[model samples]
Target: MKAILRTMGGWSQRAPTCCAVVMKHAVLWCAAMLFAALIPVVHAVAADTSLTPEASAAKMAAEHLMTAKIEWRGPSSSPKPLAGKRIAIVSCCEAADGAARASRAMVEAGKTLGWQVNVLDGRGDPQEQNKALNSAIDAKYDGIVLEFVDTTTVSDGVARALKAKIPLITLGTLRNTPDTIPDVSWDYAKHGEALANYMIWKSNGNVNALILLNTDLYVTRNGQWVGTKNVLTDPKKCKDCKVTVKEWPMANIDTQPGSIATAALQANPKINWGWCFDACMSRVSRALIASGLSSKMRGAGFDCNAESLQLIKDGQVEAVCAADPREWDAYAVIDNLNRLMQGQPTVNQGIPVRLFDKTNISTLSDYEMSHGWQGGYDFRAAYRKLWGMQK
Candidate 1:
């Protein structure tokens, strides 16, 4: 002990005694052994916390001075620019609120990105839609988007699109499959339930809802209608119900208020509430007015467009189940198309759709008009942020 003390004193005298330096070196060596001893404990704790061994290994790897590390490359797919490519967009109808806004935003965005885009209006004809799709394939568009008329009709044409080696992006309500073609859309049933519940809650259970819907369009009506039907038929949900169609949506019926104004009036003398799975911009309000029922009816419809907002302003409509229609349409088709074009494997999340009330309507409308179909979601920023391209 005396000899060791004498040696320590000699070293301290020569080095001018840094106890911190000696302690740090000792602590590091001790910690190395302590951590090694705790590995089994760490493994147990990590497992109990539901972390896999691989993740635990990665965490340890991050603290190492020398590691065989691989940086995260990207999504199973890439989102490269679609510049200098022509894309074909198909719509169920040119006149409807959702289709029209999407078409406009897509055209404008494509122009900015230097891609040629052609929109083929199906005009509510499945046969015509198929024909236009055939033309798009023959014309050799780099990417083809199929907006289905019904849930199942588009599936029959999938083989044709696949055989051509062209990426067919199915938008709106579509199916889950093992095919290379990916789907893009929001949850339809949730949207329907949320809208219905909101309306029922707003009316205080005393009002009767006149449900005007299109049975043909799968995404718009068929899928949504199923949920709406469930709610309306529920004795616990809504009190009184009557379903009427001034003109079935997408019959290419001129937006004329004349044809169904009389029928709507006759269906019920005083409509406490009105609902349309449409723009419900002008004609429905007129039907209420023409039936001399405008003063009493509180109206709600799908989509938040300029005209819809105007109706809200004029107090002709209560509220529209306004999800950013432009964004819904754009993200539905564009995200997958971009993925396919760049030879990236696409991943679908249950597409997110948010309801817009009067509080947020003005902002959503402005955002859509200024930015195509993105619905305030900056795809470029979103991708970069998601990929950790930015901190």
Candidate 2:
């Protein structure tokens, strides 16, 4: 397991000096060399014998990471009822389909409950997010849903909202610290582990991987990276697996994943698998094909976006651990808000994360992708009943 040297809340406070940054890279390079040296020894031992019982069990466990099971279990107490309440949804950015779909879900869910819904777009700007929060507070909305906005950047705004006694629920804001606000998100670590395990299984324990990481979304991306490293480096899990990383700022991810991934593949010809924390990085498909590595490399990542699914269909990517922002997470946010409004203790709404590959891609209709992916379960009626909207 990788030991976490320090903990970072949503954002990094200070940039490292040039010397410190260089020293860090030098240390990482040394570690990578040591890891690479051991790969051949591990491969030789594995080739001599069939998988031990323990190793076989580990592989089976990895395969099972593909699907998630969720149960509501009902809230502790009845909800306070929100028939005429006003709710505001502040989105980090709608440019990304995930964020836009989630915002729409929250609005529709609120309206379904006969509540007034207001949506504010942050457009990926921290200042704009803060302004939206302030506007929501000034207007005295009964509750607020913050989607994918960095809480660290809007601490003052969150503080003000808390002072106003407006219950705050967040989706995709990565601060695990104890706060008055509640965050409704998936187990990001598990998502990463699933991706790593899928790659390991597909490669038959002989895998070399390059992970495209987004540092701006460090809270979640870092967890995924750590999970990937933990599985890839464990001798029991996959002794022959070797892994490396390339970091990109989230702002540049839209245009850089392809070039950066292409360059990494060029430098490391042995790499057979590519991984990303977000499906958006699947854009690297064109670059991988252009560089002549498309046939040799398989990719996996999180999110069930249209593009990622298309890549799976085209055979450029192998798998994706899917999440439906509109149907899964957005509903959780609304359910949590309802719990808060009614004086019920919030429950962890475990959103289902399913693995989508060629075998199952046919099950998805075009409508599902054009909107956000919806899970197998119909949760609207159950949630409405919990909120006292239905008998």
Candidate 3:
């Protein structure tokens, strides 16, 4: 019995003295040892958050050192004159406020260039978008611009346009696939990282973040979350940060963001920061206040829409990553398409993204803030001059 006990490793220390009890106790000891062996495996699957306070501070310092300013890189010069060209503007949904504005901007740019522009509203239906593309192809439009339409969903339409040798450009949709043309949008991952970095620094690297995601917008939405998680979970970037993600169905954002955010905050009272992928969903300001966490928690997100900018100015939101989905994005798309028409290699027109906070919100005029802080730049005039619309 003593030799068998020695073979049991540390289980021998807990062995029963009586022979009758020995068998029962040995079975329980074996189960306990098996469970203990699995604990490390479970922990390894989770995010590693075991950094010393000193190490965390050092990591944050490195993050700060790497921070840089955002710059706008619009077209340096417009492509050779695009006079007498016929352009088709296909809008994903005119009911979508951002898409409407972008469509208008594209039409205005086409007018400035003496081009006949045809506007097609997809009405948020893929079939309608397909019809619009087919119509544009039949009409022999010189170029086509798509606003806020998922390229993958319209892959067949895109293939038809490509086969027709029509130059196509997409705006406000993140498409890295080869089937699509040049996509004019901000770097969503970088935008998300900026928001996360702000929260981490503001909380002194001790942040429990609740990320609100819109899973409907798959690529851009997930890309933003990836950036946020990468910084929040990395021990070298934020040692004391913890992240919990909750995805809201796309249809629920307009009406349910407040309620969903309230429930999430109530369930996880330790959350010190709330990060949203789109500023439109950041309408949870009232929910944050109602929970009495207004003073304790800070929120940041993308888009500098009117509500979000006001929240930032009023101290309800900590930061907003601003991009001009209304105008600049459309201009970039037109500029690139023009380049492609002129036999020049199309380039990714770098749209600028700025983080707006209380400190700088007051400095912006009302018009600028209302336009999502995009009024500060004059990309329209610059592009117009490049296209030779102005001297």
Candidate 4:
């Protein structure tokens, strides 16, 4: 590597290049080369030692590119990285924990792709999230990614942003209106319906299914309420499988599901199947036990929380309808950001949903190690390949 020297108010010193030194002085030039070689080792050590994402990014850039800003604060900058861009992640579901991981990944990806990215957590509050959206639009970010908490009210923010000519993409849910907010998310209804079909197929139309349909009125705008309704209404697919649903509010899974299950079993003693929407898979299992019928029950749900995976291993639960929640959360937003940035049309990501049973649950012990959560996406990369990388 060559080094170019920029002298200021003193003796000449060589500027560093790819490992070559450019000092006029002969003795010092050899010394500089040794130092340059050592620089790589030093930075490598820093990368290993560093903990924070920002520090790691900076260290990586400094070592590899000789000049990189891992610290830019806005989208359009000297390096013009998406890392500097301001992104608001609006979530009503408990996708934050996973989405945060995605955000970290996005930061690294942005550093590589030359983006300055920041994520705003909206906590499922529509008005509060709306204010954040307005700020991003006013700041004139190169792109904006929005996750919806309320399907209807949030539409106003999308309309306003689009009216201001901002590209706004929704993640994890879709707004059917042509209000110009292109959303990239999984069609959640497909997941719900798939689970319903699988349960019916396994049971040969005889399983009494108790469904834990998560409340979306206070959570996300994913139409969980409507989606579950649609998925259950179809009979040709579900055949003779009897289905019942209870709207479980957030965090009450620990208490509410047991009562719901007890009553359902009391009213319908042959209830052999239970399905909770996401993380509360274990709670539903316990609910079955509370009903004094754990022996006859085989349960299923989404997400790979530690307790839930163990339930799968112990045979208390039949399978998990697992999705990479963090990948779903993070890229759901970033995919939208890219669409907005490029003035391209956007659609739902339709993130893949998989069924994890006992045969494969142990092999996925990484989820056990990782708070029972999965990170990799089967859909994002595939979609990227089909649609081309976002600008």
Query: Evaluated with lDDT, which candidate comes out highest?
Result: 2
lDDT of 2 by residue, 1-391 (tens): 1323343211233644654575589899999999999999889678534654444554566556544454554343345466898999888777666677787888888887788888898866778888999999999999998888767778878889878888888887656333657888666676677776767666667779877776555355656667778888888888888988787655565668778878877777788877774434567776777777787667876677777777787787545544544566787788789888777666877576666777667767786655545765666776777666664
For model 4, the run of ten residues with the poorest summed lDDT = 72-81
Minimal lDDT window, size 10, model 3: 59-68
- What TM-score does each of the candidates earn? 0.67, 0.77, 0.73, 0.60
Candidate 4 per-residue lDDT, tens place, 1-391, comes to 2332323313433324422333335558778999999999999777566434333332232233212222211122121223344544444433433334555645544444456665666543556666767667677766666543444656666667778776656554555356455555554555454555455545544658787665644222244335444544555444355778777655464577667876776788688777765455667677766666777667766555556667777777545454445554564456546655655544444344444556555555464435544433343343344434543
Error of 3 at 60 (Å): 8.0
Best model per TM-score: 2
Ranking according to lDDT, highest score first: 2, 3, 1, 4
Worst 10 residues of 2 by lDDT: 1-10
Arrange candidates by TM-score, descending: 2, 3, 1, 4
Clash pairs (backbone) in predicted model 2: 80-342
The C-alpha stretches of model 3 lying farther than 4 A from their native spots are 1-72, 92-100, 116-140, 286-297, 322-326
Which ranges in model 1 have alpha carbons more than 4 Å from their true place?
1-77, 154-157, 176-181, 239-249, 255-258, 290-292, 349-351, 357-391
Q: Rate residue 364 of model 1 by lDDT.
A: 46
lDDT (Cα atoms) of all candidates against the true structure = 0.59, 0.71, 0.69, 0.54
